[model samples]
Target: AQSVTQPDIHITVSEGASLELRCNYSYGATPYLFWYVQSPGQGLQLLLKYFSGDTLVQGIKGFEAEFKRSQSSFNLRKPSVHWSDAAEYFCAVGVGRSQGNLIFGKGTKLSVKP
Candidate 1:
């Protein structure tokens, strides 16, 4: 079965500080990996995705992720987080023939200290 695990359940970072969220997955083939951010009372927005080719992929809102096949990980990174960045971050994997639905890891809630 395909699944994703996020080690950290919550994280607190001061504004303008670096941030990193860890994610690991288990899949039979090269799965479609994605990072999404959800704010209060809002739907998730795609941060980044890895389909194939280059491992490091850039994303919106100053976010980036690297797909490590050996480790089965796709970790999200941001050089400097903003106060508005305080939200929930999720790492997901799309497996098999599933088109829109994704298998999401327990989200990591980020708290930005002012």
Candidate 2:
């Protein structure tokens, strides 16, 4: 079985501060990892992914994630945060690779301060 874990249910940061969302995954072998963001009342949008080759992958909206095989972790980081950046972030893993099914974490809700 494959699963994703987002330890933090919610996080708050100043509008100009830095941000980091933690994620952990479990799978039998190399898994397709991803990060997505969803604004309130909106659908999920792809943030970034790690399939092969480079462990560090860049994504849209000034986001980047590093896949650490040794730790089974894929943490998302942002050098600076903005008010519009507030949203629900999810870390997911592609299961049933051929079927294209996904197992997603509970998600982390981000709040930005003025």
Error of 1 at 99 (Å): 4.6
Report model 2's TM-score to 2 decimal places: 0.97
Candidate 1: pairs in clash: none
9-111: candidate 1 lDDT, tens digit per residue:
9999999999999999999887899999999999999989999999999999989999999999999999999999999999999876557669999999999
The per-residue C-alpha lDDT of model 1 at residue 99 equals: 70
Query: Model 2: per-residue lDDT, tens digit, 1-114?
Result: 688999999999998899999999999888899999999999999999999999999999999999999999999999999999999999999986697989999999999999
Mark the regions of model 2 whose C-alpha exceeds 4 Å error after superposition. Answer: none
Candidate 1, residue 67: the lDDT equals 96
**Count of backbone collisions within predicted model 1:** 0
